[model samples]
Target chain A: DAGITQSPRHKVTETGTPVTLRCHQTENHRYMYWYRQDPGHGLRLIHYSYGVKDTDKGEVSDGYSVSRSKTEDFLLTLESATSSQTSVYFCATSITSYNEQFFGPGTRLTVL
Target chain B: AQTVTQSQPEMSVQEAETVTLSCTYDTSESDYYLFWYKQPPSRQMILVIRQEAYKQQNATENRFSVNFQKAAKSFSLKISDSQLGDAAMYFCAYVNFGNEKLTFGTGTRLTIIP
Candidate 1:
């Protein structure tokens, strides 16, 4: 569990609405990442934060924005939810070099 | 950009048998690292094994091991005496030197038949 928790384990929202997924970690790790998992595509990096207010876009950054205002909290927002954005979101924390990544249980989002 | 490839979309092995999941990556860095992660139906990503690009010896963790070929840019995971617990989607990952981000493969769904 690594003291990581994700809010709204499952969500059902209508299209064109705004949605935000929260990831909170007690480990106070320096690195936090947001990834989306799809059936054939596997896991695609959405965004990541190296530190507070320091973040970078990943391979599939479109329609996704992230914020790391605090060391333990990282937020992912989908400005306008769409059906295409429906996927299982996972938050992972690591110390260094991706040797071991602690992932939250995961959040399944559905856009109706 | 580094890319990890898991060519086997699906594989199956009988109980107590051995199975190998193939994974290949493209990276120019000399000091990168490779990893194998397993995601069961529970959806929790668990680390299975890891290999350092600088080390020549294969990494073994319990019944899980990795065959790492640095020159061929290939790192494969082998499971001996496969058990039903080994049934899951296995992902191969790569991390470049000095970078903490990991790139993952599409994953190979491994099934352990009774």
Candidate 2:
């Protein structure tokens, strides 16, 4: 059942606390992405990995960091959580030609 | 950087009626893709339909279809015989041939009236 699994489906943490959201995929697709969805902003890319050990920042990568050590794992870390960073996080994977991204059920994070 | 825009903030349609959601984008690249994604209350982003920029024919999936006006950079979603399940936030997205990141619009909240 690991098409794409995001850990702790929901999380509530205090400001300044370090929090990490994990995205695990069974698919061996080469591209993986992390995005945050908010009310009026829609979904904005945070970071993405083209392959293991290769990563790049998205438009909203200020407070977020991501790592892909293995083909199946992409981890997003909030070094210090902030209330403004609290939003629904989604992980997606895709093949080379088709841009259709399969998104995982989002992880709802709330910062206090 | 490409930008997607969904001008309508919210719209309503009576059950079984048709509704169209508008989306426009700005990009210099000619080869790219457009998409419509539905986010239900559960917050799961589901792909409604997609259109390739090079294609002249619109793409359809069941009750959902897209009207792609490439020259105009307008990609709109038309939901025929709208249902209650269609009530959700619809987002228009764009992805270039080389870039995997999907740029999304602000999204339109569609309400299905009884």
Candidate 3:
């Protein structure tokens, strides 16, 4: 665990409900990323932000959206949560994309 | 597209004994980075070791070291003096230069036997 922190470490929600996860970092890194971990799938990137207000899609960005209003905060929103979206989400930060990333303790989301 | 493969689904080693986890990757890029990450029951992703494609010397971090064969596209992790705390899920990852997104393998669960 680095200086990053994720909110609502554990949550249980229902399908079709909206959910938002927050990632905060004190390292002031230039890059931040959102990823989901599930069985048989180690970790899949959902989205990433290169700089404040600059964001891009990742390999599995569908059904997910991200916002970076500041360097320390990156938000991942599920407009309509689905059972398939239930998984452990992790947030990572790095000085650059090519550099090693520091991950936070993950947030576990469960959709019923 | 870059891909990482961890052939071992589960591995067990006696306490104080050593074990090796195999990882192979496929990539067309010449410059990239390879990493071994450990996830304990706590589910925290910890960096075990990392290797730069341009570096010929193997990377070592304490009791954890990597055998990197650029030609064979193989990067394996060797853990020495196994401890109970070492038991965890190990993941192999690859990241190509110019693109920071990491591609990960399915992961191998390591069990330390007393």
Winning candidate number (DockQ)? 3
User: Over 4 Å off in model 3, which ranges?
Assistant: none
Q: Which residue segments of model 2 deviate by more than 4 Å?
A: none
Instruction: Please report how far candidate 3 places residue B99 from its true position, in Å.
Output: 0.4
lDDT of model 3, residue B85: 99
- The per-prediction tally of clashing pairs is 0, 0, 0
For each prediction, how big is the interface RMSD?
1.2, 1.5, 0.9
* DockQ of model 1 vs. true complex: 0.72
Work out the TM-score per prediction: 0.98, 0.96, 0.98
lDDT of each: 0.92, 0.92, 0.94
Error of 2 at B81 (Å): 0.7
Quote the positional error of residue B91 for candidate 2 in Å.
Answer: 0.6
Runs in model 1 lying further than 4 Å from the true structure: none
lDDT of 2 by residue, B10-109 (tens): 9999999999999999999999999999988888888888899999999999999999999899999999999999999999999898876789999999
DockQ-better candidate, 2 vs 3: 3
